[model samples]
Target chain A: MGLEIINTLILLLLVVAALVALRVKDLITASVVFGVYSFLMCLLWAEMGAVDVAFTEATVGAGISTVVLVATIFNLKRKSSD
Target chain B: MKNTSLIPVVLVGFLLFYASTDFPEWGDPQSPASSSPVSSHFIAKTGVDTEVPNMVTAVLADYRGFDTMLETVVVFIAGMAVLAILRNFSRKKPVKRGHEVSVEPDLIVTNTVRLVVPVIQIFSFYVLAHGHVSPGGGFQGGVLMGASFILIALSWDLERALTRFPINRCMVVAALGILLYAGIGVLSMALGGEFLDYAELEKVLPVSREMARYHAMLGVEIGVGFTVTAIMFALYANLSSRGRLEGGL
Candidate 1:
């Protein structure tokens, strides 16, 4: 019961973080927040017992996808007017 | 690109959420994944036939060996694609070194990182070698190994690290790995069984069926590891180069 409560709280936090990311003006911070969102989703997948999918999400989603997106952002001109 | 377009994205997100409603609850023992015919067959036969502790390996290398072989070719193709892209468009001149930056503070950190990097590399090798017996496998180990270089690039400059492990050489090794895997498959076919059938190789070698299967799996796994590591490294190099160019560093 306690574990269930924690999982629900974590999922709620992830949704909130993702919304914040979408609303943020700074593209870089938003990208980082999205990466955090991916990490949390991987944890949720693990909690749901899809270990294989969780593993792929943790590696590809959190690691490779984040790096690629961040690198692409770095190549673009930074602006506060997102 | 507009807020209006995001309506579709929002709808897709909600659709995914709704789809999850039909999924079994977390850790339900009676889930189809746990009780499926394929999983059951693997669990029952893997131990008796393969003598391998890792059931994933038995399924990947024995039951679906053909799929694994083609997956290796896909990885090799990806590596080649990166190499082609880099060769076609990268700047010809070496990136100019700017005015001397302060090295004293960063020196200590770099030295410490350099010390730990080799240990991480060793651990990746251990993961690759023990994949047949453990939870981890070639893809996981290969990424871990590639990540060590990324750390080196972060602590030190990308240029210095690129000097030690040239992207071109990584590409060559990746292609060679695929060739080696295909050679094994062809050898199996020549010995009278269908392609990638390790049981046919048993007639030529003095080893048991289990050992032959293990050997074949190791060959393909090493190929996968090489191809994935090389392609990942290539992607990082290209992305970082683009970053440096746009950032004017």
Candidate 2:
């Protein structure tokens, strides 16, 4: 019951995060928001008892992917795009 | 928001939300995935065969070793492909951009990294070595290990990170990791069993078949960890530096 409610909340947050990440003109800001999106998805997976998947998500999605995105952004100084 | 696009997005969202009602409740024992024969077989015999508490690792590294081996190769191929593309392009045609000044690592960031990097590397090894009982294994551990190097790059510079783990050396280590995996498969085959049949490793190791499988799985996981760690840092190095292998983000 409470768990289901929390799941719904997280899912709602995920949708908002995705939308914001998509609509943002600044790619770097979008990357950071996508990191938030990944972390929320990780939490959702953890709540669903997929701890291994969640762990992978936490590390790869939130940790390494963020670094890669930031590094890529360094190459492109003009962060904003169409 | 524009009405046209907003309508489609909202409609799709509502449809998906409505559809979710028919899905199985969380942790449903009768869920198709949980009730499947393959899952049941793994649950029943994973302990008997591999003596591994973590069935995910046992199944991934032992029961389905071939697929994981191919997956490691895929990671390696990705690193190599990036190298081929970026390294050659830089050599053929050099592109110049506006002036960008290099900045020194922040005092706080460098100091914090100095304190944390050791712990992170140790934790990565723990995740790799303890996967038999824990929720972590090669891929996750490898990512953590790679991140430790990346942290160094972030706090200091790419040159400092490359000094510790050079690009050429990373490639060697990556290949060696794949070799370690394929070598185990070949060894098992030589011991009169099919490829990747870890139970046959008992002939070489002073352990029972089950224990041999357990130990072999650990080795294979380590191989995977090596490849993933190397490829990850390699990718960061090449991409961030535009294959110049000098200045980086």
Candidate 3:
């Protein structure tokens, strides 16, 4: 029962983070929020007992991909035009 | 306009959530996936066949090795595609952005990174080698390893990081990783077994058949680690420098 509540909270945060990432005009902020979303996803995977998947998501999704996205954005405009 | 778009998006989102109600309860023993004969076979015999306590690792590096091998190749290809598109090999100067400020590497950040980089590298190695017993493997370990180099770049500059791991050597390491994976598979085949049949390696190694699979899985993981670590750094280096391999963020 406790686990269910924690899962629900994390899921809610995940949805909020996803919406913020998509809605934000600043690409850098979006990427960082996307990192938060990835970390939340990692947490979700861990809670589901898929530790391997969670570890992968933490490293690849949250860690490396954020840096990669930031690096790419540096070469372009930082703000969303639309 | 955005409000109109939101309606369909919300509808689809709800539809997807409603559809997900059909999925079996988490970890349900009676679920179709859990009750499948293939799952039972793996759960029952993975220990006996590979002598690996971590069934996920055994299944990934041994049973589905071909899929993982191709996945590594896919990573390599993706890195290459990015490089092909973004790498500016010409000697042209990078356009200066108005907001760019040339700043020296901070003492505190560099000092902290100096202290942390080795620990991260060591931990990555532990994750890679110990993945057989734990919840990590090549991809996670390799990403961690690559991030260490990236940390160096972030703390100092791309040149400093590139000095330690140059792009040319990065490519070599990435290719060698793929070669190592395929070589192991071919070696097992040459030993009178089907491709990727790690049990055949027992004739060469002193270990029993089960141990052979275990050790072979380790070798495969190492190959995966090598490719992932190199490509990760390479991707960052190229993307950050816009392929000029010069001054970068």
Candidate 4:
């Protein structure tokens, strides 16, 4: 029962993070929020017992993807279309 | 635009939540994925056939060795693709213009990286070699290993990191890793077994057939580790630098 509540909360946060990442005007902040979304998803997967997948998500999503996205944004003008 | 986007987002989220209700309960031992004969077969026989404690590693590096080999090559190819696209652009511009805009490496970041790098590298190898008993394997270990070099790149400057693991050397190591994997496959074939049949390794090795598969999986994981580490830095160096090989973000 406790696990169910935690899972729902995490899922909610994941949605919120994704929405904020989309809504944000700053590309860099959006990308960082995307990282947060990745992290939360990893946590959810870990909680579900897919430790291998969670590890990959933590490394790729939270670590490398953030770096790549940030670096890609650094080369662009900082403004968002919205 | 924001409101329009929000409608679809909320709709999608709602649908996803609704759909997730159909998924089996968490930790359901009888879930289709875990309850299938294929998984059960692996669980039952992986220990007897390979003598490796970790079923995932045995399945990945032994039963599905060919697939893993190709996956490693794919990583190497991604590094090369990034280099191909970004390298020339960086080279055309003067390198000095890069440093003018780049900040000097902060003392704290550099010091922390210096302290953490050795430990990270050690852990990467442990993850790679210990796949027979742990949750880690080639891909995970490789990513961790690559991240170590990337940490060097991140905390300091790209140049300092590159100096430690140069771009040319990175490519060579990446290619060699895949080669090592294929070489083992070909060796197994030559030893009167099918490709990637690690048990065939017992012909040349002193260990029993079961132990040969166990040790061979370790070698395969290490090869994966080498490729992943090299390409990881290579991708970071290229993408961050826009191929100029200096003053990477």
Question: Residue-wise lDDT of candidate 4 within B1-249, one digit each (tens)?
Answer: 747987987999999999999999866898999899999899899999999887877888898888989889899889988887777743355534433377778999889988988998888788777888978888878888888888888887899899999999999999889989999989999999999998999999999999999989988988998899899888888888777888758
Clashing residue pairs, candidate 1? Answer: none
In CAPRI terms, where does candidate 3 land? Answer: medium
| Model 2 Cα lDDT, one tens digit per residue, B51-122 | 999998888899888999999999999999999987754355444444344777899999999999999999
Ranking by DockQ: 3, 2, 4, 1
lDDT of 1 by residue, B1-249 (tens): 578988998999999999999999666768998789877789888877777788877787668877877887786776566546544454675443342232333787798888987987887777678778875566766776777776666567667667767877877867776776777788889999888787777887788877887777787777777766776666676676652422111
Model 3 chain A: lowest-lDDT 10 consecutive positions: A73-82
The whole-model C-alpha lDDT of candidate 3 against the native structure comes to 0.91
Q: How well is candidate 2 docked (DockQ)?
A: 0.50
Indicate the TM-score of model 2. Answer: 0.90
lDDT of each: 0.71, 0.90, 0.91, 0.85
DockQ of 3: 0.56
Which residue pairs overlap in candidate 2's backbone?
A: none
- Summarize candidate 2's per-residue lDDT along A8-62 as a digit string, tens digits: 9999999999999998988899999999999999999999888889999999996
Q: Judge candidate 3 at residue B236 and give its lDDT.
A: 95
Model 2: per-residue Cα lDDT at residue B220: 92
DockQ of each: 0.28, 0.50, 0.56, 0.41
Better of 1 and 4 by lDDT: 4
